[model samples]
Target: MKTTCKSLLLYVLIASVAVNAFDPFTATFVVGVGAALGRWIYEYSQEKCDSKWIAFNATGLETDLERRLFGQHIASRIILKAVTGFMKNDNPKKPLVLSLHGWTGTGKNFVSQMIAENIYKEGMESSFVHVFTSELHFPHPSQLETYKTQLQQWVKGNVTNCAQSMFIFDEMDKMHPGLIDSIKPYLDYYDKLDGVSYRKAIFIFLSNAGGESITQTALDFWSAGRDREEIELRDLEVALSLSVFNNKKSGLWHTSLIDKNLVDFFVPFLPLEHKHVVLCALAEMEAKGLQRNLDVADRVARDLVYFPKPERVFSVKGCKTIDSKLDYYT
Candidate 1:
């Protein structure tokens, strides 16, 4: 808990000086850039020059990931490096593309929110961030053609408005088979397509596909008595790619996105265990302004369901349902 407190305190202090104001709620910015000045200007906005974290805070983001996001060392490292490199580069050859794969409640969405909050002052609410859910946005199969046209237009329009626009696609497994390929042209390496350059945009896909393979690998590592941190990207990247490509249930099944190597990275989120869940519950306790109680956190963690028969090594739903379980105890 002291670590979290220290991180937050240090971040607040640095953020205050970075923007020349402390309060994240009501501070106004004096942006000089013509493009940035027109933005609705959330509580955080500043002239980004060279890689000074841009409008983003590298230290704060790393602290947040380490302090709150438990388990999955591979994920935290991959996300930080990828984002930092992309943001620092002024002339990226192609937009940053990442596909996060894992079981439910494995912190995919949480990390996504973290990225948004660090980049834009308003976070997910920022107009520059556009989120689309497969189940909600494209529900019908008959409208596949129309959805394709609209999706392309939506992406083009948003990126044209802001060079640093972010696009997040959720539940890709639920999306239609051919739907994802609609925007393939935009994700390619092109200086300008119809007059707009997409080299500065970001695309993130979140899905449950390839989760089974990831869990099995983690289980194997555990059975061997090896450290989870030792499991590197090379260990799972190949198997994950093949599994998602052939898995008929996935939205990217046989899609060109994987075939042509359009995806820059395929990040895997391992299933959570008992210790991780306890940490999550404790964090929840802190967030709720309640006293940190290990007893209550343990009780909440024990109450949640686990899987793999009698061994019960992995969380079935990850930490997705931890908030409600914590609420029961508090």
Candidate 2:
């Protein structure tokens, strides 16, 4: 509006200088052009601002994240609740930060993808969704300083540009502790932070750091003749946090995030049972548009390796390889 008004005034001045008096017709034409330009500018600015509001599909996310993630009832439920609250909170003071801890192939990554797919119209391909794997992006220990700088800048730049941005850091167990701490600022609560508010952003960290402790807790419950369903978030919360903080291999060890309690949730993906594996196999078959067969699913489940020779408790790889293992039955 300012630019257009200035240009219009300049045009009238030039016209008046050229012809002792400004032509009313020329002045009217310039004013009309300025009005059009001002409207265009207003529209452009609105579009830019509206681009930050993501089309979050809460209902679809509930179905996909819950259905796809098996053998993790407690974790899935907590995730759904946290996400629902996060989305509904109009003016959040901190980013929604989640630390997913569990065994490999136990649906940590799968759940993350489900969240991304449902929240983003472009699914996993959305530019607003950023994924970083330690193996792929932070492979060198010597580059920890550089990685920290880049990570902070990347997050600040994205969140500043789009408050609804989402970031996923995979294989977080391999990321440096220093690097992990770099994200603490964004997760901390402040009325106004760094001249930019990150209250609407989302950050997810995936790792196997607490898998052993989680599995053991589950196993203890099973041995005590308790139903697997009895295991709850309250049961694992303290253990999971301690494991992540005390384990030397975990990137979060001794981090201020734990002390400040910045992590919104510690969701643990429990080990998958045979029934969960069967469900996974069935889902995979359905994805291929193949008819479901209980016999095939049963065989695939039996063939999967389980731990503790006698008990034969949990699937070694959970449902991680269930899709590929289904081919053997064919």
Q: For candidate 1, report its TM-score.
A: 0.84
Instruction: List pairs with backbone clashes in candidate 2.
Output: none
**CA RMSD, predictions in order:** 9.4, 9.4
Off by over 4 Å in 1: 1-54
Separate clash counts for every candidate: 0, 0
- The candidate that achieves the highest TM-score relative to the unseen native structure: 1
lDDT of the candidates, in the order given: 0.84, 0.83
Candidate 2 — worst ten consecutive residues by lDDT sum? 44-53
State residue 50's C-alpha deviation in candidate 2, in Å: 4.1
Q: What is the TM-score of each candidate against the true structure?
A: 0.84, 0.82
